[model samples]
Target chain A: MNPTSLAPSELAYVPFVSVDNMMKNVSAIGVETVMKGIADYIEEDFLRWESFDKKPRIPAHAPQGVIELMPTSDGKTFGFKYVNGHPDNIKDGRQTVTGFGVLSDLSTGYPLLFTEMTILTALRTAANSALAAKYLAPKSSKTMAIIGNGAQSDFQCLAFKTMLGITEIRAYDIDPDASVRLARNLATSGLNVTICKTAEDAIEGAQIITTVTADKKCATILTDNMVGPGVHINAVGGDCPGKTELHKDILLRSDIFVEFPDQTHIEGEFQQLPRDHPVTELWQVYAGQAAGRTSEHQITLFDSVGFAIEDFSALRYVRDMLPKTGYFEKLDLLADPDDPRDLFGMVLRAEAGRNGEAA
Target chain B: MNPTSLAPSELAYVPFVSVDNMMKNVSAIGVETVMKGIADYIEEDFLRWESFDKKPRIPAHAPQGVIELMPTSDGKTFGFKYVNGHPDNIKDGRQTVTGFGVLSDLSTGYPLLFTEMTILTALRTAANSALAAKYLAPKSSKTMAIIGNGAQSDFQCLAFKTMLGITEIRAYDIDPDASVRLARNLATSGLNVTICKTAEDAIEGAQIITTVTADKKCATILTDNMVGPGVHINAVGGDCPGKTELHKDILLRSDIFVEFPDQTHIEGEFQQLPRDHPVTELWQVYAGQAAGRTSEHQITLFDSVGFAIEDFSALRYVRDMLPKTGYFEKLDLLADPDDPRDLFGMVLRAEAGRNGEAA
Candidate 1:
């Protein structure tokens, strides 16, 4: 009656992309090309936003930090990312945010892919910002002012260069060493980079501004006077409750855009305004149902507090690239028996195999 | 400027228990003994139930089945289980239910362990049922009738033998092959086994009755006339909305005990009852705040819907066993840089290493 008379089968294996292989894949295919590919997928998904099953992320909050699960399904494919935000982890040599994600088949509910998402998240976030800028930023924009240089700074700068053709970067951080590290990492990326002394100095003549500070509290990284007309603002750091980077006055002046209004109202810059504050859903603009940039001198804000659809697109991109790169390992993560009803029989076979018997 | 100048570090690696290693661990510690150990952890966690965070599982439903995420935390440690229920998966040589889980440190929000929970879920679910029986079942029981002899049948039978000293098993299933398979799997175990042609014959002399039928729709495998007095019924398979095994008349007469009332009302036998129907919480009984078995004439029913806390306890038990068994593999699942803020720098170093240059 033992259907699986011997050992484990191929059905038990799942594909896993580790950090080393993810980096290898990035190098195998150029990083800029990878980011552009992710950006295209994000835009494609956004164009059909009504097809998805969406919900706000589930979060477990602690005094020190929070861990969250962001899940979404598009009828055929389902994806989720497990992520954490711990601002105090920097002193102990840990990332402020780290993540991993899974994509599964909706029909069978079997996981098709598991990958390290810390690096992928940076790429997708940058790509999402650049994608928004393409719709809202001025046509001749060539320079970007990056305030609060951190781990995501280099990716954002490179993604802009790849997706929007930006050629110059003016970077600043409260700590000078962060700016130095960003410049050092981007040394050979073919963009003119300048280290600025203050936030005002960074945004002096740039057409686009990006604020990505890692503080857990409310801090004004950009004020009303700092944001000029016709300039696009990518606010990425204020993503949780009690976290905001732009002053309320700046928000009042800029026409805001967001991923999902329900979530943005609680975590994005919209949190500073009333619940009825008018904000555009990014998917609407991508779908051509809403106007993106109506005038030459309008202030456009992409209040970017990352979303699950972007992660889904990132996972989709990685899964598509696996065949070309061959950069994944098979993990024996599921138990499969020949006769599914005989799971206990399979275990007994394992014990027999352990005892050197060929039953 | 590179924090992880050479290669990956200890922090980048997370311990993973594959299906093969899980089988080896089960064999290393005897299955009966392992079930008993898991039962202890389940009871221990139940005693401090109020200290843990709880939530109804987040589910994504498809026409074929459903995928769910069950998450919980106890302030210090966090755990989540990813599971799916596709009753039709058996036709395609897959288990009806498959799962995997992760345990993490809440302070740093770093994953400590990732393990295959398909087999572990079976162990935990069986342990959970047996633990409930220890409280609700009549003290002088020696035989159990398991109505549906499918994947979870053997584990449930062995768990009772290990946890409650049950010495006889009378099993029945619609598909007679399933009962034969269960008998073959438990042949070496010391308990006497019998295959019954009818559900009525199976429960003729049994003190405890377990109904674990697998059907997505509602079906009454047991009726009011089938149930007798002083019988403790373990309703194991009626665990999702619109899926139940027992008749409503049986539930009306028995004093029902449940894991979590909110979840049980939606998924357990309580779904047949009113929303505000009275049911005793099993945790309260374990905590000595409520009663278990009161009189010889009273019929007790443990409406087992399964909860996130049991998965947490299962993960905790597996993590503790890993050190002694040494049956796990290390996976490079996290991106750890020497300088936590130098995530981009670490990727650049990987590029350098790939190009045969010293980082």
Candidate 2:
């Protein structure tokens, strides 16, 4: 009746990347390089978009903010990000958006990586924005106007500079100090930074304009007259219902591109448009199944609501780099019994260990 | 232009309860006491279930198994459990189900605790079953027939003994070795145990029959003729679609009670019946809005598909016990920047720390 016990501590360990380690990894790899690596993974996943099981985020909404679970799988690997968006959190010295995520093996249903996604999310969001700009922006694009100089602004600037050879950065925020902070942070990024007093000034002669203002209500950061021809607008902050940055007129005039229509139609700038409005899936452009930016004068809008696949790609990238970077610690997250059916015996053994009976 | 830096490292740390600590906590509090505590919390939450934002689990199904996220919030607090069910995993020295959970402060969108839920789930599930039986079973019921002698078997045995004063257990498993192990694990407990050769033999004189076999198919673990009147069937095995442990004829005869009918209809034994089949919500019974057991001869079935509210209650219980037990470690899982807008600067600070300059 007594089953022989076996060691299972190793099976219980799951690699965990903490904020300190994530920052060290990013710093060691160089923020721009890590972002590029993540972007490449994203592009690779996007090219095989059909392989993924995608779903709209499951959200629990409250008065102060929203908490959401974004899960996606590529049949072999499963990944999900737990994120919370609270605009007023800044008053308490917390980021407006904070998150963490897990990546697991589909075959075993065991977690491969548990990591902080607050920094990773910022990086991946920028990488995704720049990736879309690469496909939708004019080939000669160089200057990028960043209309939101907040937590995500600097990442967007660096991603565009690294991914698209962007040389000029025009930054503007409702709070002028945010622009100043953005300029100072990118001082060593080698991009020419200019702080603008107005959104219009920030977009002057800019081929790519990224609007990432954080507000819970619909606000026009960019209007029809403000957006000219051949401009790729990356709208990143209209991520929840009743919250958007670009004017409805701009969306009507631009050729809209979205990550997942099922989601974007509810949370992105596309929410302003009718349900049946014509829009292109960005993965189609990555797969070369659909055209992107056919005319020089045609406006293109990347409704950057951020998707689950992008987080999955970022998680995969972090997991792949762990062996080389050694920036993660092993966590005893799963209970691995010697015999899976004898879980009760494991508890008994732990009790024995506690009582100095097991040696 | 440089924003003043503030201390935020403290804010980055979240309390994490590992598997080792979970076992220690369970052993320290005694398994039966922990189950009773979790059962009390389950009952308290069920009484006010209308306040919770309830949703069916978000599941990602694959060939090998399924991974799911069960999330719920009471407006002030948010909780979720990440669990996977892979029946074949046991063959590889892995559990059929393993889980971890997070409890967050919804007001701030910050996680209050992250803990291993594999053991906690076992305890909570058993407590939930016993609590349901307390409301549905005959007042004088003292014997429980457990058909599955697997990982969850011991917990169920202890829970019934602690919660309902059940003094005798009749255990049976397809694998005789499993039955032997179950008997060995509960040998120290003061409950009378009998190892049975057949499922029919196990339920011979038992007033409450619990079926918790692990199979991914439509299994006829119990037949209509086998179950006598006045018996409370605690069906806990068949949770996913296309999985049923009991026969359809037995289902038609018993008064079914379920947690979240929307989910039970798809995952519980109710999946076998028509969409409009009558069933009572278990929470309604807790809130005194519906009947549980009307007469001694009335057969009641607690279709335990497992719901988010139960997991939320378990998480709440664990978080409350952390300070007293001190069985947790701090995990730096969130990015806390000095200035909320200066997340990039936080990275720069980390870069400085990596370069041996920050100090």
TM per prediction: 0.98, 0.96
| Candidate 2 similarity to native, TM-score | 0.96
RMSD of 2: 2.6
TM-score of chain B of 2: 0.96
Candidate 2 on B1-359: residue-level lDDT in tens? 22234234778899999998998888888899999999999999999988999887888878899999999999999999999999999887888899999999987789999999999999999999999998999998899999989999899999999999999999999999999999999999998899999999999999999999998999999999999999999999989899989999999999999999889999999999997999999989988899999998999999998999999999999999989899999999989988987888998976765466444
Model 1 quality (TM-score): 0.98
Candidate 2: interface RMSD in Å?
0.9
How accurate locally is residue A144 in candidate 1, as Cα lDDT from 0 to 100?
98
- For model 1, the stretches where C-alpha displacement exceeds 4 angstroms are A1-7, A357-359, B1-5, B357-359
Q: Distance (Å) between predicted and true CA of A214, model 2?
A: 1.1
- lDDT tens digits, residue span A3-97, model 2: 23423467789999998899889988999999999999999999999999988898888889988999999989999999999999999888889
Docking class of 2: high
Error of 1 at A14 (Å): 1.1
Name every residue pair that clashes in candidate 1. Answer: B3-B338, B3-B339, B4-B338
